[model samples]
Target chain A: MSGCRDWLAHLVLGLGAALFLLPIWLAFCAATLDPAAIDRGELSLVPRLDHLGVFLEVLRHGGPGVGPVWRMLAVSAAMALAIALGKIAISILSAYAVVFFRFPFRRTAFWIIFVTLMLPVEVRIIPTYAVMADLHFIDTFQGLTVPLIASATATLLFRQTFVAIPDELLEAARMDGAGPLRFLWDVVLPVSAANLAALFVILFVYGWNQYLWPLLAATSPRLDTVVIGIVKMIGIDTSTEWNKVMATAVLALVPPVLVVVGLQRWFVKGLTEGEK
Target chain B: MERRTIFPGWRLPLLLVAPQLLLTLVFFYWPAAEGLWQSLTRTDAFGIHTRFVGLANFAALFADPRYRSSVAITLVFCAAVTALSLGSGLVLALAADRELRGRDLYRVLLIWPYAVAPAIAAVLWLLLLNPQIGTIGRWLVALGVHWDYALNGTQALLLVIVASAWKQVSYNFLFVLAGLQSIPRAVIEAARMDGAKGFHRFRTIQLPLLAPTLFFLVIVDLVYAAFDTFGVIQAMTQGGPGRATETLVFKVYQDGVVNLDLGSSAAQSVVLMGGVILLTALQFRFLGRRVAS
Candidate 1:
C-alpha cells in the first residue's frame, strides 16, 4: 500500500508539472503555425517549419498603427534600463548608508522603506497615474521609468546583502586611508558582486516583465512595451487572429525568457541562497 | 581614517537616501495621499476640474451592487487561487523531495510557466479554452462535457483561477521545495520508526516543519492575486460577459482608465489598499507568531 501511494504521488506530480507547462509549450507551437492552418482549427502537436513565415510577417508587418519590432525592442530596452539602473543606484547607495552609518532617524528610515513593501504599486495605481498626468509625463519614457525607480523590495534585498558584508573589511579600508566613497567603490562592491548580480537579474526581469504601469502610463502605441503590445495584439474584435497573437506572444516572451535561462543560476542563488 | 566624519554626519545618509526618498515621495507617498484626497472628492475628465464631495464617492461605492459583487468575487478569487496553488505546490514539493530520476528536468519544466508574463498566460489560456477552436474546449466537447468560458460564468471564473494558480505554483513549489530540503532526514526516519508513514507521517511531522514556508507563501500568493493578476483579467475577459470576473483591481482599472471615473476609481483603490493592508497585518500577526515558535 505504501509503495502504491508513493507511485501515485509521483505520477500525480509529473502530470501536474506537464499540465502547468502545457500552455507555454502550446503557445509557442501555435505561434509557429500558419494563420490559415490555425484558423482551420487544425490541432497539430508539432508546428510545421513552413508555417515559420508568420514570425517574419509579425516582424515586418506593422499592423495598423503598430511600430516595427525593432522600434518596440529599442523602447523596451531603453525604458527597462532606465528603471533598473535608477533603482539599483538608489538602492545600493541607500543600503550602504543605512548599513554603515549611525544617524538620526536611521531606524525610522529603514522601517519606512520596509513598510512600502506592503503598499504595492497596484494599490497606488490610480493616484500614481494622476501624478504622472500632473507632471506632464504621461506617455513619456520618464513617466514609465520614474514611478518604478524606488523599489522597496530591492532596497531591502540590497540592505540584506550589505549587512552580510564583514565589518572588518570596511574597517580595514578605513585604516588604510580609504574614504567611505573609496571603500565602497574598491572593497565593498567587489565582495558584493555576486549579490549585485543576483539583484540585477531580479530587477532586470521585473522591469522587463512590468505591464500594468506601462499600460497605464503609455497611452500611445509609441511607448508600449512588449507586454502591452502583446496584450493589444489579443484583439478587441471577435475575429481576433489567434496565430498573429500567438506569434506576437512568442516574440514578447523571447527576451525575458532568454534572460531567465541565461542568468538562472544567479537568479536561484539570489532568491534561495541569500537568506542563509 | 580619522574620526573626522565627512561633511556633517547627517549629510551623507541624507544624500545617500536622497534619490530613492525623492522618487518614493513624489511617486508613491504623494500619489497615495492624493488618491485618499480624490476618493473623497469629485474629479472631471482631463483631470482639470475637481470638487470636494466628501464621502459621497465612498458612500456610492459601498451602496452599489457592483461594488458588493466585486468584493465577493475578489475574495473568492483570492481564496481559491491561494488554496489551489498552495495545495498543489506542497504536493509537488513533497513528491519531488524524494530521490527521483529526471528530478532536475521536472524542476525546470515545472518552473517554465513562471517565466511567462501574466498577460501572455491569459492570452494563451484564452486561446486553448476558446469555445470553437480551443484545444481543451474541443477535448471537453469530445468527452461530452460542454465547457465554454464565454457562455458560462463559473467556467470563466474557474479558468481564471486555474490560470493564475498555474502561473504561481512554480514559485510556491520553489519555496516549499527549499523548505522540505532543509528538513533533516533524521526527523522523517524517526517518525517512520514510530509507525508514522504515508499521510500520517506527512501530516504530523512534515506539515509542522513546513508551516513557516507555507505561511510565507500564503502572504506572497495573496499579494500576487490581488495586485498582479490585474493584467491577466484585463487580457482574458475584460471583466467578462456580465461583470462576472470583475475583480476589485480590474474594476479599479476599468473605472480609472476605461470609464474615466477617477473619483470612484480612487475610492475603490483606497478600499482595496485598506483590505490589503489589513490582510498583510493579520498574516504577520498570526502566522508570524507560529513561524517564530
Candidate 2:
C-alpha cells in the first residue's frame, strides 16, 4: 500500500513538474524548427539538434522594433547586478544602523523606508516618471537602476537577521578594538553571509524581471532590458521571426533561471521566509 | 527589536542610512506625494494649464463605465489567479511532500519558473496558445473549438489569467512546501495512531495547520495578480479584445502613459495606493501572529 501510494505521489509531482518544463521544452523545439513552419502553426515537440545554432543567430541580430539580443541581455545583466548589489549594500548599511545604533529619528527613518512597501512603481507610474524626468534620469542607466535600489524588503530581512545577533558578539568585537565599520566587515557580514546570498538571488531575479519600470524609464532602444526587448519583439507579430523570438526567449530565461536554480536552497529560504 | 549592545555615535549610523533615506525621499516619497497632488488637480492636453479640481477626477472615474468595468475585471482577475495558483500550488506541494523518491528533483523543476519574468511567461504561453502559430492553440482550432484569444474578450481574459497564474504557481509551491515540511511529524504520527489517514488526515490536520501560510500566500498572490501581472497583460493582450482584460494597473498605465490623461490616471493611482495600504494593513492585522515571530 505504501509503495502504491509513493507511485501516486510520483505521478502527481511529475505532472506538476511537466506543467512548467513542457512549455520551455516546446519552445526550445520551436526555436530549432524553421521560422516559416512555426509561423504556419506547425510547432514540433522534438528539437532539431542540427539547427541549434539559431540561439547563436538570435544573439547576433534584432527583430523589428527590437535591438540586438546580446545588447539587451547585457543591459539586463547590468541592471540586475546594479539593483541586486546596490540594494544589498545599502540595505545592509541601513539595516545595520537601524539594528545596532542609538540614534535620533532612527525609527522615523525606518518608517519612511517601510512606507515604500505601500508604493510599488505600479501605483506611482506617472508621477514617478515625472520625477525621473525632472532628475534627467530619463533614458539613462541610473534611471533604470538607482531608483529601484532602495528596498524595503531587503532592509526588513537584514534587520531581522541583524537583530538576532548576540550582544556578546558585538562586545567581543569591540574588545578587540574594532570600530563599527571594522566590526561590520569582520563580524556582521560573515555572520550574515547566508542571508546575503539569499537576498542576492531574490533581488537579482527581481531586478532581471522588471518590465513596466524599464518600459517607462528608458525610451531608447539602447537601454532595453531583455524582458522589455522580448515584448517589443513580439509587438510586431506580423513581421516577427518566430524561431528567433523563441530562441531569444530561451536565452532570456537562462540567466535568472540559472541563478534561481543554482541558488535554489537560499532562494527558497529568502522567498518563503522573507516575504511573509 | 534593537540590539542591546549598540554602536556609540549617532553620526556614523546616520551616515550609514543616508543613501537609502535620500533615495527613498526622491524616488518613493516625492513621487507618491506628487501622485496625491496630481490626483486633486487637472491638466490640459498640451501641458500648459493646470487647475485644482478636488476629487473631480475621482468622481469622473467612478462615473465612467470603462472605469467601473475595469474594477469588475480586476476583482475577477485577482480572484481567479489567486484561487487557481494557490490551488495548484497546494496540490503539487502536497504530492511533493509525500517522502517520495526524486522529490528533490521534482522541486528544482517546479521552482525555477519563479524566475521567469511575467512578460516572458506571457510569451511562452502565447507560443502555446496563439491561434495562428501556437502549438496548443492550433491544436484547439483543429478540434473545432473556435479558439482565438485575439478576437474574443472572454478568451483573452482567460488566457491572461492562465499565463499570470502559471508564473505564480512556483512561488506558492515554494511557500506551501515549506509550510508542509515545517508541520511536526510527531503530530502527524499522533493523528495516524488516532486512525486519521490520507485525505481525511490532510483535511483535518495538515490543512488547518497550513492556514497561516495559506493566508499569507493569498495576500501575496492577490497583490501579484493586481499589480505584477502588468507585464503579462502588456505582452499578451495589451488588455485587448475591446478592453476585456484591462485590470486597474493596466488602465493606470494606459490612461497615464499612453492617453496622457494626467488627472484621471493620478486619481486611479491614488486609489491603487490606498488599496495596497489597505491590503498590507489587513495582512499585518490578521497575520501578525506569524509575522511578529
Candidate 3:
C-alpha cells in the first residue's frame, strides 16, 4: 500500500509540473510560429523550425508606439541591476548598524523603516509620483528605482542574519585591534556571504519583475523596461502581432528565470536555515 | 533579539544607517504624508487653484457605487487568488514531501515560475487563452463554448485570477514544503502507529501543525493578490470588460494616473493604506512568533 501511495504521489507531482509548464510551452511554441499561422486561430503545439526568425524580427523591428525589444531588455537589465545593488548596499549597512551597534534612536530608526511597509508603492502612487516630480526624478533611473527600493523587508532579513552571527567572531576581531569597519569588512561580510547571495537573487528578480512602479515612473519609450514594454505591445486590438508579442514575453522571462535557477541552492538554503 | 556583543558607536552607526534612513524618509514617509495631505486637498484639472476640501473626497469616494463595487471585487479577487494559489501550493508541497523519487527535480521545475514577472505570466496566459489563436481558445470553440475574456467580465476576472495565482503558487509551494519538512519525523511515526494514515493523517496531524504556515501564507498571499497583482490585471484585463475586474489597487492607478483625479485617488490611496496597515498589523501579531514563515 505504501509503495502504491508513493507512486501515486509521483504521478500527481508529475502532472502538476506539466500543468505549470503547459502555458509557457505553448508560448514558446507560439513564438516560433509565423504571424499568419497564429492569426489563423489554429496554434500548432509543435513548433515550426523555420519560423524562429520571429525572435530576430521582433528584436530588429520595433513594434507600434514602442522601441526595439533590445532597448526594453536593456532598460530592464539596468534597472534590475541598479535596484538590486542599491537596495543591498543600503539595506546591508542599515541592518549592520541595527544589529551590531548600541545607539540612540535605534528603535525609532527601526520603527521608521518598518513603518514604510504600511503602504506599498501601489497604494501611494499619487504622492510618490508627486514627490518624484517635485524632485525632477520622474522618467529618470533614480525615479524608477529609488522609491520602490524603500521597503524594510530586505533590511529586516539582513538584520536577522546579522543577529545570528556568533559573537565569538566579533570578539576575536576586536581582540585583533579591528575597528567596526574592519570587523564588518573581514568578519561580518564573509559570515553573511550566503545571505547576500540569496538576497541578490531575490532583489534582482524583484527589481526585474517590477511592473506598476516602472509603468508609472518610466514614461519615455527609450526608458521603458521590458515588463512594461511587453505589456504595452498587447494592444487588445486585432492588429497586434501576437507572434512578436509572444516572442517578447519569452525574452522578458529569461533573465530572472536564469538568476533563480542558477542560485536555487543558495536561495533555498538561506531561507530554511535562516528561519530555523 | 538583542545581541550581547557590543560595538559602541554613535558616529559610525549613524553614518551606516544614513542612506537607508534618507531613502525611507524621502521616498516612503514623505510620500505617505503627502498622500494624506493630498487627500484633503483638491486641485482643478488644469492644475490651477488648490483648496483644502477636508472630507469631500472621502465623502465622494464613499458615495461612489463604483468605488464600493471595487472594494467587493478586491475582496473576491483576493479570496480566489489566495485559495487557488495556496490550494495548489499545498498539493505540490505535500506530494514533494512524500518519499518519492526525483523530488529534487520536481522542486526546481515548480520553483522557476516564481521568477516569471507577473506581467509576463499574464501575457503567456493571454496567448494561451487568446480567443483568436490560443490553443485553449480553439479547444473551447471546438466544444461550441464561447470563451472571450476581453469582452466578458466574468471571463476576464477568471483569466486575471488565474494569472495572478499562477505566479504565486511558487512562493506558496516553497513555504508549505518548508513547513512540512520542519515537522518532526517522530510525530508522523507516532501518527502512523496510531493507525492514522494518508488523508486522515494529513487532516488530523499535518494540517493543524501547518496552521501557522497556512495563516502566514494567507496574509502574504492576500497582500500579493491585492497590491502586486496590478501588473497581472493590467496586462490581462486592464480592470476591464467595463471595470468588472478592477481591484482597489488598479482603481488607484486608474483614478490617479489614468483620470488624473488627484483628490479622489489620494483618498483611495489612504483607504488602501488603511487596509494594508490592518493586514500588516495582523501579520506582525501572528508572524513574529512563527519565524515569519
- Candidate 2 displacement at residue A111 in angstroms: 0.8
* Cα error of candidate 2 at position A246, Å: 0.4
- Report the lDDT tens digits of candidate 3 across residue range A1-276: 889878888887888889788888888888887778788986767887788887887787767657889888888899899888898899989999999998899999999998775467888888999999999998898889888777688788889888889888888888889999888888888988888888888889989999999888878887899888887888646577777888888888889999998999998777655531
Between prediction 1 and prediction 3, which has the larger DockQ?
3
lDDT at B13 for candidate 1?
84
Q: Name model 2 segments beyond 4 Å from true.
A: B291-293
Best by TM-score: 2
Interface RMSD of each: 4.0, 1.0, 1.3
Highest-scoring model, lDDT: 2
Q: Give candidate 3's whole-model lDDT.
A: 0.87
Q: What is the Cα root-mean-square deviation between model 3 and the actual structure? A: 1.7
Give the candidate order by descending TM-score. Answer: 2, 3, 1
Runs in model 3 with CA error above 4 Å? A272-276, B291-293
Question: Positional deviation of A273 in candidate 2, in angstroms?
Answer: 3.2
* Better structure of 2 and 3 per DockQ: 2
C-alpha local distance difference test of each model: 0.78, 0.90, 0.87
Report model 2's TM-score to 2 decimal places. Answer: 0.98
